[model samples]
Target: MPVQPTPGTPPQATSRQQADSAQRVELGATIRRLRKERGLTLVQLAQRSDLSHPFLSQLERGLTHPSMPSLHRIARALGTTQQALLASAVRADPDVTRQAIRVVRCGEGLGVPNVGGMARMLGSPQLGVHPVEYRGAQTDFGDYFDHPGDEFLYVVDGEVEVDLLTADGRVVHQLAAGDSLSYLGGTPHRWRALGDSDRFRLLAVQNATDPLTGTAEPHG
Candidate 1:
């Protein structure tokens, strides 16, 4: 039989609420610690992460909770991953559920568009390697961009032309279905769709941590 508590009296409910409040406080402190360690003010972090300043302040004060996606952005701005921050939060909470494994269903990827295409984040809680699907990149040439860490790409559907612009010279590689390419980080590169297909699809996995912030390298 279920026990009903009279108005203004409930022990179990009160305990649960207290626990949740404590957890929120701990999470906020953890985020504040990380932000300070990175030498980032709330304004700087918010600008870099595309988050609003007031929201960040509220989060740091434990006055509000952030959704998973917002937490991911905050973690990235602090040079960490969402998985790491969640692990920290869980460590402080006594009522934690198992988090060793995660599964993302098909057609539910986080989609973000770039210069010439769409990039879908393959899974949540980004870890060591960031996996993304690049599709609908129908351009004659890509704006050369460079960032920290190595990159790998596999052509899953159609052919494409990739140009690797390094200090040595300009190298072009034409990739077809089932073709793959791996390149070192810091190499300026660009790509373009080929063979007259309406859309081109590729699986690009990057192991870079440094945020991309620059212009096209001069062709030399």
Candidate 2:
């Protein structure tokens, strides 16, 4: 006969439950680190990801877990992919020596889901600069972005109209194939494809870390 557990003793966690708890803790730490690296407060991250502040706080504390969609939103807001985030979380030592040269073959890269299209990461996170290729079908005027470091955009194909919101007023620019634009950090901007083309392709490069010093301006 097997002996019963002591009275009032709580049941032990199963292996699966233990594994899940470990993962949650790791993921939460990774999220918090990435947020701080981007100089974002929990509230700011919540706003960017369209997630509730309380939920994000709980997630960061490892008291709660996020769904796949929620994770994707967080990844997008942090300017990273889900795979990269997960890899960072699971790695024993992130500071390990990285490969001197990394190569991404044609049509090979981490694909990130976008509002009206897809974005692929062409550069590794260890490079300190993120190079992304965006292919979009529908125009997205509602998607405005502002972040901590400078950004450069090159139109690989098709045309796009960009609106930069400066302190004085909004400035607009029309870009076509072979055209490029660069902007300082913390500038509010939005862009949409021009013409009736089925899709447009753009190459964007941005700093992966916060380059600004002092307090960061609140993003509207």
Candidate 3:
């Protein structure tokens, strides 16, 4: 026998469960794609991340979900941030077919949910380039970490200040809204919002690594 639901009402628990399942599958596919792009086999990734090979295989096959710590380890092993993997999972399902163009609409970018503050990746995934949008009250210089390439930042909305400091704690230059900066990466730098609003938005582009090979291309 079949039971009918009331009008305008659905099975909330079942619907939620289905949504979670779909997300798990999508995340698995994303991880698998990244692993292949980095030329890493399941066994290799497992060894690098210190996770069991069988567990990683199950994660990639959508048989299980990974905890935050596990995901972070996997991301580190893959030479990417956890934010990127999460964004990929939310933005789209795995697409092996390469596209000539990719589009992201207003309010439709992939949010970096795990990261504190508001940050999102703009547009579809592009090779060797990461375009990010950041909206927040301030940024910390201590959080200014280093990676392989260079960076370019533009103030898209509100006002902010950027500081470029030398290794010995000297401020080389400062930038305000409507001003842009480009510097070779590996230099210590950071920024913060200004004015009464205490809000700022920025568009930053930086070099990205290949998920399959885990190698970064030089970007100017």
Q: What TM-score quantifies how close candidate 3 is to the native fold?
A: 0.58
Clashing pairs in 1: none
Q: How many backbone clashes does candidate 1 have?
A: 0
User: What does candidate 1 score on TM?
Assistant: 0.52
Instruction: Judging by lDDT, tell me the better candidate of 1 and 3.
Output: 1
Q: What are the TM-scores, per candidate, against the unseen true structure?
A: 0.52, 0.59, 0.58
Per-residue accuracy of model 2 over 1-220 as CA lDDT, tens digit each: 1224566655542332443455556668888988998999999999999999999999887677565357667877887644345434323222224562446455444444555666665654355565778887357675566655578999999999989998888999999999999998678877888885455898987665521231222322
Could you give candidate 1's per-residue lDDT for residues 1-220 as a string of tens digits?
Answer: 1234457867866544454455556567778888887788989999988999999898777667665457667766776644344434433344433552334345433344444566555522224455677776756874575545478999998889999987789999999989999988778878888875456898877662522221122212
Candidate 1: list runs displaced more than 4 Å. Answer: 1-100, 124-126, 208-220
Q: Lowest summed lDDT over 10 consecutive residues: which window, candidate 2?
A: 211-220
Clashing pairs in 2: none
- For residues 108-208, write the lDDT of model 3, one tens digit per residue: 44444322246666534444576778776444332444444478888876766666666677564544567777866566566666663245777877766
For model 2, what is the C-alpha lDDT against the true structure? 0.66
Ranking by TM-score: 2, 3, 1
In model 3, the runs with Cα more than 4 Å from the true position are 1-77, 81-98, 113-116, 139-142, 163-173, 196-198, 218-220
